[model samples]
Target: MSNDPLLDELRAHEEQVWDALVRGDADLDASLLCQSFLGVYGDGFADKSAHVGQLAEGATVQSYALTDLRARALGSDHAMLSYRARFMRHRRNQAEDMYVTSIWQRTEGGWINIFSQDTAAGEATD
Candidate 1:
């Protein structure tokens, strides 16, 4: 998380996603996503169902962490969060790092991720 007040709040909601992924808790994952949630990945975009369905398909992340988190408020009920994430896939035994941006909207139900875009952040070279 950054020094921005808005980013701090957004970071908490974003953390929920990581927690759900590492725990393989699809229900909790779904709770953080909007019904029409759209995730833009390197391959393409995934809707809320398909995104959370990865867990059901047995995709497990053994460990994960986030850093360099930054956020901007779009309006009173909306925010955009960006961060660098590192995680290992248990099935593949490979670790990956990426920069991600997720758009969240605060509704009566709470903050739900409405959209996300991930960019592969490879190893830093000297």
Candidate 2:
């Protein structure tokens, strides 16, 4: 972890998101996102409902690890977090690598994800 508190805090929030995916906790996942949350994935764009809806069948992700996290303040209420993620989906034998960027906004409730983008890091090797 880094010495920066913002980086650490944001990393924790990011991990929560991944944990939700692994556990298929749609409620937890929904709680972390803003009503207007937008996600850009290799497949296409997704809104908050679509993002949370993926968990309908339970546990979309099997496991995940985040690394090389970086965060920058986008004013006082917002911050951007970027990192590399290696994760395996449920029923998938191979893990996939991706670089992700997420924007979070501080609200009266707490930090909520406002936007995110994921770029595939080519293919995973054995």
Candidate 3:
């Protein structure tokens, strides 16, 4: 990892978002997501609050982990991140391992996640 605090902050922001999702913390989700944030799911898109609102209802991430994380600074106020994630949703008895890309924008307060896209690493067939 570079000695760049901005990159560190960006990773922290990403972790916070996942943690908030797992914990179903609406306040944390609200704090981390931007007003213009967009979460691009495979089926469709969701705005910031509405997306987090789902988490607040009953969704909980059982375990979440990020690996192979790398970050690039796009100008001064924006950063891009790529990583592999492994997570489980206990309620659905579902698990996912995927590659994720996220874009973060700096705000007056701190770094906030503005966009996210993920692709699933499907199960192997033999």
Q: Against the true structure, what is each candidate's TM-score?
A: 0.90, 0.95, 0.87
In model 1, where do residues sit more than 4 Å from their true spots?
1-3
Top-lDDT candidate index:
2
Give the alpha carbon lDDT tens digit for every residue of 18-115 in model 1.
88887889999999999899998988889999889989955378788889887888988999999999899867677899999999999997889999
Q: Is candidate 1 or candidate 2 better by lDDT?
A: 2
Error of 1 at 85 (Å): 0.4
Clashes of 3: 0
lDDT of candidate 3 over 6-75, digit per residue (tens): 6677778888888887888888988988899998877788898777888757547888888888889998
Q: List the residue pairs that clash in candidate 3.
A: none
Candidate that scores best on TM-score: 2
Question: Candidates' lDDT values, in order?
Answer: 0.88, 0.96, 0.84
Name model 3 segments beyond 4 Å from true: 1-4, 123-126
**Ten contiguous residues with the weakest lDDT in model 1:** 57-66
Q: 5-115, model 2: which lDDT tens digit per residue? A: 999999999999999999999999999999999999989999999999999999999999998888999999999999999999999999899999999999998899999
